[model samples]
Target: MSSALSTVIIIAALLAAAYSLVTALRDRAMGWDHLAALGVLEALLVAQMAVGFVKLAGDGKGPDDTATFVGYLIGVVIIPVVSAGWGLLERTRWGPGVIVVACLAVAVMVVRLGQLWEGAVV
Candidate 1:
């Protein structure tokens, strides 16, 4: 995986997470902007998936454990999507709270992804 791409995903996820956190603190419901940010984040994740897959297929550098790395890649994509669906159904402060939690999860996964890419553990 590209360090630059990984950095971009990390920063974007954290920014979106912060936004969701603030909205949740304010007791606001999820809105269009919140969904939009998540959309962008999801796009970045998809891009990362493409890049990761290409790298792996082309015999590019990857984790010592490929399965775990790919599992994380799949997870980051699912987190926001699942949370957003549940958030919409919630229609309360908890909606934004769902986003916040999902974003935070994504952030953690991104960090782990970086660690896997760099051959670091824990």
Candidate 2:
């Protein structure tokens, strides 16, 4: 729910997404650096999940639609893993493309999460 944390997540996701897109456009193979970035992003997301749960439990100021919030949180946590797995399976530029898409999705979700934390609804 902290704006600072949400901003960090959004910036990180945008940076990663841009990097992945550039790599994909260049037709480069998947590399350890990209994977490492994804790993870091995943860690940040996990931390966010923890903070979010604590805040939600204490204040209950989050989205009114509990199911949607939970779904978004779950999706946010799983994206990096799913993208990394799919990337590893292909060994092509498309692998990086998958990562790019995932990162973009994460960024958007972070924004939505912020809105939800502010008691916004669909």
Relative to the true structure, candidate 2 reaches a TM of 0.93
Colliding pairs, model 2: none
Residue-wise C-alpha lDDT for candidate 1, range 1-122, written one tens digit per residue: 87888788888888988998888888888988988999999999999988888888887566899999999988889988998898888888889888888988888888898899789977
Candidate 2: tens digits of C-alpha lDDT, residues 1-122 = 77888788888888988999999999987789889999989999998988888887888466677677777887899999999999888788999999999999999998998777666765
Task: List runs of model 1 lying over 4 Å from the truth.
Answer: none
Local distance difference test scores for all models? 0.87, 0.87
Give per-residue lDDT, candidate 1, residue 115. Answer: 90
Q: Global lDDT for candidate 2? A: 0.87
> What's model 1's overall lDDT?
0.87
Q: Give candidate 2 regions above 4 Å deviation.
A: none
* Model 1 weakest lDDT span, ten residues long: 53-62
